[model samples]
Target chain A: MNPSLKLAWVVLLALELSFTQVWTVNVVLIVICLALMIWRRVAIKRLLWLTGVPLFFASALVWSLTLQGSASHHFLIVIFTRMFVYVYLGGLFTQTTDPLTLTRSLEQNAHLPAKFAYGFLAAFNLMPKIKAEVASIKAAALMRGQVLHVWSPQLYFKAILTAMHWSDQLSLAMVSHGFVEGAPRTHAAVIPLRHRDWWLTGGSLVLIQVGLFIGLP
Target chain B: MKAWHLRDIILVTILAIFMGVIFFVIGPVYTILSAALAPAGLQPLANEILLGIWVMAGPLAGFIIRIPGAATLGELLGAVVEMFLGGVWGASTLISGVVQGFGSELGFILTGYKRYNWLTLVISALTTTIVTFTWSLFKEGYASYHLGFLAMLFTVRFISVFLFGGVLTKLITNLLSRAHVVKNVR
Candidate 1:
């Protein structure tokens, strides 16, 4: 499926699940997403950690509900399954879709501006450099007898100061490379929204509604 | 807003990407905190406590760029970065980004997008607290909590938002300016 369609499907279902607490639908969604993730060869360890941690927390939530008796059993179930639903739904997207493809699809198919899209792509490519810079900043701070924790402002200030410098140089390079603002350009990789993606998205959405109408829960 | 220079766009993306890394680092802390709070039925507090930090990019970007949609763009891009970095929230991160960014943007809009000061940052934090809290009321089922609990959550959220989004944003911006690092952007 195209990234845009996949994103739309997941986001729509998340919004739907938020408003309604249908555990049956949640179960179906979870099973399908889990299957996809497994088939896609998502690392078993990461999958287990993702779902297992949430499972532990969900059980705690149910236990708290039982002790408090504030909400009913059904609501507890809804909350419990909703956690898995969100995690799996999110995992399906992040695991299945490549970030570069997603950005290209968003820009070409979803009308995202090229400036923002290419800007993101540039920064995304620079992530490794930025990460190294962050480490060096911490090392430099330590050398200066200063301990910069993750939440330290000095750490961010030093890192962002470097970022400001990189951005200026990067933007200048992009412009000198004949990149014009707001001009349409040809794509080296055309991320087209195929008909199958729409069919799958529409078909699943309709199937879910039909099942819901027939009282799947 | 004037036409966005390619430099401005790159600057904002870099800044947002940086904040996204911070958010990613903090993600595990939030997860552990929320799981710990779950047993006490206080998981919501985890979000409230960290929301200010989460919304930091919006106001900080707005202050630096000083454009019409810079706050929203910065926040939305930050969420995008978070997702690409394998954030657990996945697609829903985009939704939260839109809501949080719009909330932050509202503050600057109220100031006519001219005054980038403490007052604007405070207003941005206030709006972010209220907006995200309201979103939780519907999305996270915060409406089910008791009135006193809700009030307490709101207060904590506001304080957190003010401290990180408002106060910390100002501090960082000041530090950047003092070092003469971001003089070219403005």
Candidate 2:
């Protein structure tokens, strides 16, 4: 499937899950996501960790729902459901879609600016490097016998400056290679709008409509 | 570099992506903070207070880029990048980005983009906190809470934005300026 289509699906499901308060519809939606994860061979342990951490933090929410129940308890459930479903869908889409494919799909299909799209993809690529820069900054701070507090403003300031340096360097390199902001570009992959795309989109719409119809009561 | 140059795009993208990562990192911090306060029935306020820090991305972008829409682009790009990185809130993340970005954008706009001072930073932070609180009133059902509780939430959140988002971001921006990092973009 085109990453854009998957992105659309994720966007739709997330919006649908947002206000869906009915337990039955929520369960159905979550179940569908869980099934997809299993089909994709995503580790059950991964899913457990994803769900467990949030639930652990929100233990008070569970306590309130069970003990100090109120009308807004339903709202709580709906919001949590929205959170979990979004995580699952987002995880699925991101895991399957590479940055190149995403940029290509976005440029061809979504009409995003080439320079901007590629610029973003380059930034995404730099994420791992940014993490490394942060680590080296910490290491250097430690070498100097300065106890680098992770939560301290100094650490953030240093990290951002390092990232900015890298960004400036990379921008120059990209420019040297003939990248123009408003210039035209070509795509390697032709993203076709196929039957499955329609099936996924149309099916999601129908399910969301049904969910809303049942959830409103 | 001229205004809106390739360098500007690079700075915005990198900052946005960095903010996206920061947003992810803060998730755990927020969870822990809120959980700690859950026993005291201050969980709602905990998230809001910490949320002040999230506003830093917008103002910091505006401060360095010194361009119209820098704050909003920083915020919106961060949201989109976060969603791409599997943010749990999904599309609502985009909504929050737009709202929060607009709040800071209003701050820069009100000053005619002339002043990049502390007052403008505080205004940016306050605007973000107010909009998020109002958004919570409907989206998170804060309207159902007692008036006293809501007021407390607002107060704590205001202090939080003032400190973390406003003061801390301003400090960091100043540090960058001193380090010559700001010159690359400015």
Per-model clash counts, in order, read 0, 0
lDDT of each: 0.82, 0.72
- lDDT per residue for candidate 1 within B1-186, as digits (tens), equals 576777888888888887876666787788888888877877777778888888889998888888789999999989878877766777668888988999999999999987767888888988888888888776655666667778988999999989888888888888877887544232
Clashing pairs in 1: none
- List residue ranges in candidate 1 displaced over 4 A: A60-69, A212-217, B180-186
Please write out the lDDT profile of model 1 over residues A1-217, one tens digit for every residue. 8998999999988887877877898899899999999999999987987788668757765665454346666777888898788888888998888988988999999998898888878877988787777778879989989998756788778767777789899988998999888998899999878889899999999988776667655
Error of 2 at A130 (Å): 1.3
Q: Candidates' DockQ values?
A: 0.53, 0.43
Q: Is the docking of candidate 2 incorrect, acceptable, medium or high quality?
A: acceptable
**Model 2 over residues A14-69: C-alpha lDDT tens digits?**
65555445655766767877787788887777777667755653455444333333
lDDT of 1: 0.82
Candidate achieving the largest DockQ: 1
For candidate 2, write residues B1-186 as lDDT tens digits.
Answer: 235766677788788876666556677778788778777666676676777777667887888788898888888888878776756555567767777888888888887888778878877877877887887665555665667767877898888778876888777877877887665332
Q: For candidate 1, give the lDDT of residue A59.
A: 73
